[model samples]
Target: MDELVRWLGVQLDADKARAAQWHDLECSIHEHQEGGLLKAVAALEVYGEVPGAVCDCGGPARVLREIDAGRQLLALHLPTPYQDEGDRWPGCTTCSWRDEMDDLQVRYPCKTVRLLALPYADRPGYREEWRP
Candidate 1:
């Protein structure tokens, strides 16, 4: 249970960093500016210390930061993490970030979390949107 909680914490951090792009929320340990899209990490020392994670880009940094800021909450969404890295259990579907798909995040740590954003209008106003 403890292991599950810890990894989930990491996952949540990654997810929240990306979420900060469209929302005014602190997703990291310190305050940072949002980038062109979600999961977009800001410059070094520009906002605060960069997140030390598996990700090597600003995007993942953004997500991690968001988690630290408490903008998004994470729960054990799955029973396991591929291997036996953690314990598997029932009722692991209580994660809040599990069902919400915002159009700002392109991907997540170790996986791709698709969130598409299309231009709106004649000059940034509206046009058409098609999702399948």
Candidate 2:
């Protein structure tokens, strides 16, 4: 079995016209609507200063970057999945746990990254009212 499959995230074009629709799709795909795992898409931006202070990862921030449209933007893949089977996944950045949220937020800004609940069997595994 492919190992990265469990840590996969898709980067789709963000359509201004279909922002909500794309988000719904993102929720379906990245969150592993099937039985794989959660995925994420991030838009890269370059700034002179830190976006915000994160609980120092015991080291300096790992400034990562990705290329799009022939331009390099600073971004990194979120190390977590966003869905689960039987409504329970493993790991903090990968599970649907309340405490897991803090782990992600500290590294990836909540506003910049989104959590989609794509589950297997063509069903979404997210709760709109649930905040974690």
Once fitted onto the true fold, the runs of candidate 1 whose alpha carbons sit more than 4 angstroms away are 22-132
How much does each candidate deviate from the true structure in C-alpha RMSD?
16.8, 19.8
Minimal lDDT window, size 10, model 2: 58-67
Scored by lDDT, the top model is: 1
| Model 2, runs deviating above 4 Å | 1-75, 80-109, 115-123, 129-132
Tens-digit per-residue lDDT, 1-132, candidate 2: 112222212222222223433322122212222256544422111212345422222211121122131111113323344444444323334222345444322322121233321221132332333222
lDDT of 2 at 18: 37
Scanning candidate 1 in windows of ten residues, the lowest lDDT window is 111-120
Q: Candidate 1 residues 23-104, lDDT tens each?
A: 3223333333456444444444344444542223445455456455442333223323332224132222332133354222
lDDT of 2 at 124: 39
Clashing pairs in 2: 30-39, 32-118, 33-118, 33-119, 33-120, 34-119, 34-120, 38-82, 81-94
Error of 2 at 51 (Å): 52
